[model samples]
Target chain A: MKIFNYFGNYFSNRETFQEIIVIPVFATLLAIFLGLLLLIVSGSSNEIALKALIALFYGSFGSISSISETLTAATPLIFAALGIAVGFKAGLFNIGAEGQIILGGMAAVIIGFSFQLPFFIHLILILLVGALFGALYAFISGWLKATTGAHEVITTIMLNLIAYRLLDFFLRIPSIQKEGRNDPISKSILDTAELPRILYFLDPNLRVHMGFLIAIFAVLIVYWLIFYTTIGYEFRAVGKNLEASRYSGISPSMTIILAMSIAGLLAGLAGASQIAGVLGRATPGFSAGIGFDAIAVALLGRAHPIGVLFAGILFGALIAGGRQMQVSADVSLDLITVIQALIIIFIAAPVLIRKLFPWIFR
Target chain B: MYFKKFLKISSGAFAGVLLMTINSANAFTACQVTDVGGVDDKSFNQTAWKGVQDAVAKHGIDSKLLESKSETDYEPHLNSMVNAGCDVIIAVGFLMGEATKNAAEANKDSKFTIIDFAYDPTVPNILGQVFATDQAAFLAGYVSAGVSKTGIVGTFGGINIPPVTGFMDGFAWGVKHYNKVKGKNVQVLGWDPDAKEGLFTNNFDSTDDGKAFAQNLYDEGADIVMPVAGPVGLGSASLADELGSDKLKIIGVDGDWTQTDPARKSVYLTSVLKKMDVTVLSVIESVKSGSYSGGVTVGTLENGGVGIAPYHDLSSEVSSELASEVEALRKGIISGSIVMNK
Candidate 1:
């Protein structure tokens, strides 16, 4: 928490890899170590799980294209993490990234299916529309908070539920949904909407897509906005002391609305990235709790932009590695979730983490 | 701390080796991935897993079931099976069509038997087994229509996917056919096919949602309801059991609900039966013989792929004359004497 003072409206001094990569690497190792202990204590053989872990490593990282999948999973998290991190920096916890993503994805799907445009134009249309829709969604909670003094936590949670139903409903549009059929998912995006694989020359199935580009750009934009802009000052000022920022003539409500809208825009872009760049279509529960998971990323990264980037990478690796781990080790994927929850617990209670590892924290 | 990471990886490896060596001694290998729902789901996943276990006990196959929590779990579970050297991998549900297709293609030499729906591109080393659920659902819909006191029957499905919707469409058609043939008008309310959003918990794991959804239909004066959701369908049965007192009944799907839900026989009028156990066992047998290949395995009423399970508590409800009438409807459906259109 002492890092909060140093995390002022600046760039190079505020960003570092230690909190992101170095810390998370150590944390993940520790979590896995503890997970293995639990396995042995439970009377399950660790040998089986170990081999599965090795296989997972090879499946995700050893192969030339495996890193591509790892990157694929990371890209969305990066966008999502950036969104949530930004939300935290602004002192508004927008836990509705999941809902925003869904809404964004459906908006993208609607645009992707309803119009017939050039490939480049079609792709851009989906991206902008999705992000715009996401901004509009986040604005709802912002409006509620601004008007009725409602807590964003409750409203966002309710909004997520509402978004889930709305996306499912959106997929029912005849042109957007399956033609001549009723299923919760829209038809696959047009070929033009498909985010071209990054390494098509090497192997067509490798998952590198345009979403990765968008994610990196998103991080860069986030970094720039937080460190170099006037809006950034107002945002930080409001988050630090809403009453004082208001006293300083910065409209707290407007800043809150803008912060949430920007955060939601990034989140919606995450959805568009996943659909156009990863999944290629909208389906129920498609966001897969990345929004909630992004909160962990923000905390683990100490709410630093560069740190969130690396944190997103680590999470992407774990998820990417999970399949391989399960295959090679025969360790259940539940182990991964268990490991993630543990890391979050430690991250949430950094003092407990320090207590567990006195030397490292000191 | 670094040493801990090393120990974690090594010790876990040590444990994995020990278990593999032990399980290798088993006779036959059985592997299954439950649809989005786990094995306890009373529908396809549960019935299908039971079939594998039954096959394991009967055939002495060493079986392992991998419960998929979500779509992301598919590739990993299938890969784990392949890593474990499971000889026969059976994927349950049509939603698994694309996932199984992709996994099957990657592991060409590994024999696979996928139940329900085939990928159009088709993998060379996979067996796509689909049942004649339409034929079976027709039977259930007929019975529900026949047994309805209010003449207003109802049906709702989880996902509106073809396989799930196919059952719904066929059920509605069968109900309509029954009404037209008897020269009687039986009201029918089905899950709206053209709803803005498809009605799927997507999880297929929640029984409570299924129950609540069914109760709404029951409250709307539906005497009989058929749920296409797998295990979640049991929720409908639960509500049907409670509310089925005088004006409500539920038609079960996938397996013989009479055998599965014997205690609640009073509420379960009959089940649309797809002999999933037979379908799975046959696929396992083929893999054992080395003839497992990519092709559509169609199960129709002609092959006993579909039918109406025998009445357990409703034996008295179906008089000997009504039983004959049900039998005639089945024959008519089979012989193309009756074509059901939805």
Candidate 2:
């Protein structure tokens, strides 16, 4: 009854709830409608398009395995999205999450394969090293922004290229690379370092692991930092008005650096989680554009922690469902990307949604 | 008016949903999961898809393809195909070797074929389709040397991967062979088979890098250039066309550039064919006919698995005597009389 009252009180706060929930839901529906329109324009038969949509939904949540796949896909996006959302609160755009992710994952993999420790300590050390490396990588850009006024957008993008080349070069080292393979393949992490599967008893095919729980905990921690902490207040103040924040005795530079460091820490955790929990080994293109996609997740989620979580899952469902759509209805997986782009566009331009469905605003 | 428009759209969508509920069943379904290059790569993935399409036409087997945007998509795509009841799954590219092997091991009943790679301690349900493209590339090399008036030819790769370097090695060897027989020094630039190093774009996707590398090679007085860089080679072909046929010639790879990109036919000297389509079609046919077996099927020059494409418009430029010599060289290579450095 107490929990029900807490939820009721939360729901009774209509404006905040609507801002956080209603707009995203409506934008998603509108995007799907436009996606169906795109399918029709592309000469897909009505039945085929409908079947594809059904397959997409079913593939996401049809069974326990399907649900597990969705969660698995959502895990990394959630972590990365939360990281992006943290930066958004501080008025900083960390486009370098992709590089940070690669570096962090590489750091985790190095520690994961090299060490011989107990399971609990090993997992904690791996995650810490991964997050620390990610933070350090982002701090360079943040420090540059503070001291030299070099725009992070340009610096982060350049850093991403450097990170890719660095990973390629590092993978070539005979010790780092898997033995007997000249190709850019890394050795698998030791079994002790791996995140135990959550559903191994039911079916070992379920790749979901403790990483999903870690992501949820990160979300709670981020929420607490943003709404219930002093640094969070300063970060928001700097974001809202930098001059006023300076006038009020908040050092904008300090807030910016801390914000970016925290952001990188979260992104790094994403990389480490993916490596330790899902992919036991890193390949040349292992990060797989998830860092870039997290930008969309952050925007669609309205740069809020709870919003980012739901948006990550939504994007995860789209990916998981895309394969099923391809298998069942013969639709191209490219359609998922198109739909994702459309959703982001619709959400970004809320006026378009308002104009299309004016009654929703009323 | 808005209400009416919404009603009409909703009705149409409802009708679509109703129609979609009825799906016809097919007897056998063949599915392919492509590498990060996707289906329209105009290279291995595209040619292998043609083979799946051929099976659709010949054996009436239902075909579908799942394109992997990244390496992470491999296992999920394979699992989805298996769960969706695909009778045979074709995994393209060496990047997919591990994922396909694992999937095949798990689902012993499901037949699988992987192109461009093979597994050690082979799984019973999986067949490896690998091509010895160097032999055909040697012929291309010899012919390229025969036609170059500048007495210089160059080749570069997308990466130093084996499948890619195989073409380069054979081309260099063919040029060496040409030099040995004719007693003429035809310089082969960009690759040294002995050192196993060459000019590479370090990536398969960059056309600008391809254009720059080919431009540099052309600037070095090499009139014939072979690029083993997928679509990146198209940049070199375009460069050759811009330079005119008299100034430069391009040796294409994977499929005949003449057929793949007919608009640029005049620039193509010849393509060192991998014949991925033919091999893929044969695998599908075996599955359809219940003759599918798990083992390595080497596509070599002797069995018509790999060969040089017809010289197309450049045939008029080649002397009959030189063409016959190139053919004899191919036969020699196939018969083991002329062994390649592989």
Candidate 3:
């Protein structure tokens, strides 16, 4: 506690507001600049690429509807990235966000079908079930890491593969599949069970759901947990130096398991949001690469809760603008992924960008 | 700093060069392809794009292509194209059926054709061009039995939807008919024509899912496995390519597998062919010549719309007697002597 306040005071006068936001914001510009270079090298028009980039930004956040869409996308990303971010901060990389999400989503699917609760109750039930599922999934990896000294990276990746197969097999079980369609996807959640759109009173065309608000609340909770709580201090302590933390009377084994479980819960919520809020049912690979993207989001956000929220929104904007990119400038949408990859690269080596954009940091 | 500015200027100039394309007609405005996978998918999207290019060649229509990043894209991309003054729109996939349907109704004058989804005209401007992938798949299934070292055969799809289920049905039925004709037993698994719904991936995005299914089939001792999903079909081909075992082969779909896999062409026995390019080209031709139809354009083997692919490297491997048997099977299917089911 003393360390936080004393350290906080030491850095209190470090930079202007523009310096802090400007560096990351300008890092994005540098990334886009590099992305344009790639597009030119790939034999595409710079005019078209510029138009697409502009269109992506405008289509995602320029209009009220577009902003809503970005929030819709960002909502799930915030949960997933925050989940991964916690693990990242703890120095335990969780690569099974996809599987954890799939498992969590499947749990939500089962709950969504079996229950006949009130709207809020149903939503809470599904989220809790999804979170529990993700926590359990992460726990296994944690267990393996805690007991067998298996690397979290390798174990989590393998667990992701296992989760993929398990989800596929589990979706085939008759009780889970949509009736008649007997398809891999579960039956759609009931309309009442669905996460209600806050903007329905305004316009149905926009997809700004209650989940986005929930995601914001989740970010605050995570921030508070990490910064204010006693357990959070133990987690960070262990993450910094396991030997030192163990000597400081923190149970390394328990922290490892608990941290992973919490991480899993977030990932689970990510999937549950998609099911109850976005897609309304569990479809195979429906989580797509959101889990992996969360890693990138965490890296770009510098593993901070507040940064994750903004980074998630930016990533969400990219997704929301994907169609506009194709429509306006005739540029391929895959460039978004490339640009995302570049963000990670640039953020990892911010010194390079810092050198290039001295005015940004200044 | 001067050198850096000069570098940026040179890049901008180079970017300008890439924007250049030859324009032969003032009226030939460009159109873009929202290929769900990519242009090189060698499946429905690629076949339809071929037709688009053919139409472009015949009528001097200007166009380009853009692949879809994810499923959420269907509506926004279609709407964008419509807003951009694209006269005719072609979206490939059953999932995009809804998008094209919505876009067609919204943009009534804008002509749209969608592959894999056959439906009655909701909006007169929209043409749902669906293929009987089952008809072609059945032809391949029957041929598989003639060449199989093992009695077990396999087939899978992107989803249990009508188009995919139809292919599974025909393939399973074809194998059954082949057994009946040869007075032998053949067992097939994975896709059941009689089932209420089929086992499927639901979306055609992943090669890994298809790979798992194909590996399962091969492990279970199936001599041949056919995958109906676009890029997903390449999954089965990959397994076949990995092994030199003639006992395990892939029956390709859309275009010919033999043409696609020249390296492991010997192990790729045959394909259930859907001539999407032919169907799409005809639609474009009809529309261009002012004879466009509003309803479903069903492609059946009976109409030469779908058929069995030619055995390439496996041509010599297939006995002359077996080749003749495949020909007879195709004829029997077309003549209604063999009925592949709903």
Candidate 4:
């Protein structure tokens, strides 16, 4: 009974409850409706489209293995999205997450292969080094923003380009590359450095690891830092209004630098998790586009830590299920991107949803 | 009004779900997972998919395709096919080499074939399909040199990878062979066969970069340019068309440009063909007939795996004497009289 009351109070006290829950749900439904409409317009039978949708659902959450795959897919997104959410809270648009992710993964893989230490210590040290590298990569943009008023958007994009070339250059070096192979592939991390599979008992093929748990913990830490701590207050204050924050004895530059550093740290953890947990080795474009997708995840989550967690899982499910949909229903996987775009469009413009369902708002 | 719309959508979705639940039983299921370029890339992936489609049409085999949006999708896509109970899985592109190797090792019972890349320490269930495309590209190089009025032909790649550089290396050698035979000092631009350095866009998708590379080669006084970059090569064709065929001609790669890019057919001198479809069909056939074995399958000019496409629009441009000369060179390369250094 006390737990119920605590939950009720938690819900009632937050004015953002509707923004965090109601709006996103409504937008998702509307976007799905529009996606079905598109399927029909594209000449797919109603039965075929729905089968594809069901296949997507089953593929994502159908069984233990499927759920494991979903979590595996979501792990990196959770870290990167939370990082983006934290940056958003501080009114900083850190578009350098992709670059940070690459550098972080590279750092982790370099340390992972170089060391021969005990399991937990090795993992912790590699993750920390990876995060530091990511933080330092983003610090360039943060420092530039603080010192020269350079927009992070531009700097981060340029940094992303540089990071790509730098990775290619690093992979070409003889020592870093795989033995007897000229391709841009790095050596596989030692088995001891790998993040042990969480479900090896169930089925050895399951790829989910401890990264998901770490991501959840990061979410809690980010939530506490954003809403409960003094630094959190400063971040939110600066985000709400830079001039007012400066006048209230908050150093805007310091806040900007701190937010970016923390954001980079989270994004870096994402890279480290992928290397130490999922891939177990480094390859060119290993980050894929997860860092970029994190922007959408952050926006859809309304830039809240808890929101980002669920949002990451949702995206992960969509990705995992999209493969299943392709396999079972014979639908093109590109449909997933279309659905994602539609959801973002509806979320970005809430007026349309409110206009269509005014009674729901009331 | 919203409630009515919701009812319509729900009913449609319900009907769709019912239709999807119906399963079809088949004797064999063949699946393909394409690289990041997807199945409709109009290059390697597309051609490989055609082979899968051919198996479905001819052999009554169930077929499915999954496109990888990025590098991360490779493992999952392969795993999904394995989970779906596919009898044979085909992975296209050199980028999928590692994932295919890992998948083949993990699932020993499932038969796998990889295109454009060979695995080291071969696995029992996996067949690596590789093409000696340098042979065909050599033909393209010779043809381009013979057709060049300015005594200059150029070639560039998407990256400095072996598959890409194989085309450029052969093209450069063809030009070198042309100079040795004719005693004419025809210069090849963008690549130095001896130094192994040349121009590359470092990507396979950007048309603008392809156009810039082609333009750069042309600016250096080359009338013929061959771009080994995938979609990037289209930019070169487009630039060739824009500059007028009188000033420039393009040598296409992979599939024949006359068929792949009909709009720019006029600029295509001929294409260096890599018969991915033929190799893929053969692999599927082997799996279907219970004759599949794990080993390397090399596609060379001798086996019709790699060859030069016909000079379609440019057919009139090649004299009978020159056509016979190119054919003789092809025969020489196959018969061991002529050796390609690269």
lDDT of 3 by residue, B164-215 (tens): 7777888888888877878999888787677544557656757887788888
Cα TM-score of candidate 3: 0.83
Accuracy of chain B in candidate 3 (TM-score): 0.88
Residues A1-362, model 2: lDDT tens digits: 54454333331113266556777888888777678778867988766767777788888887787888898899989998898888888888989899889989999989989889999889998899999988998898889998888998998899999989888888778888888665677888888888888988998878789999999999999989988899998887787778999999999999989998888888898899989998888887889998999999988888888888999999999999888888888889888888898888877666666678778668
Off by over 4 Å in 1: A1-30, A37-43, A49-66, A113-122, A325-331, B1-34, B51-68, B71-91, B98-113, B118-126, B177-185, B191-203, B241-247, B258-266, B313-316, B335-342
Q: For this target, which candidate reaches the highest DockQ against the unseen true structure?
A: 4
Judge candidate 3 against the unseen true structure and give its global Cα lDDT, from 0 to 1.
Answer: 0.75
Q: Give the per-residue lDDT of model 3 (tens digit) for A268-344.
A: 99998888887777666667778898888876666678878999998998887765666555666778777887887
Query: Where is the poorest 10-residue window by lDDT in model 1 chain A?
Result: A5-14
Q: Where's the lowest-lDDT run of ten residues in candidate 3 chain A?
A: A6-15
Question: What level of docking quality does candidate 3 show?
Answer: acceptable
Q: Estimate, for each residue in B220-313, the C-alpha lDDT of model 1 and write its tens digit.
A: 7788888888878778888877765466777888888777877787877888887788888877877777676778888888888777788888
Poorly placed runs, candidate 2 (over 4 Å): A1-15, B1-25
Global lDDT scores for all candidate models = 0.75, 0.85, 0.75, 0.86
TM-score of each: 0.85, 0.94, 0.83, 0.94
Model 2 DockQ class: medium
* Cα lDDT of model 4 by residue, B303-326, tens digit: 999999999988888988889999
Q: Chain A TM-score of each model, in the order shown?
A: 0.91, 0.95, 0.92, 0.95
Residue pairs with colliding backbones in model 4 are: A47-B16
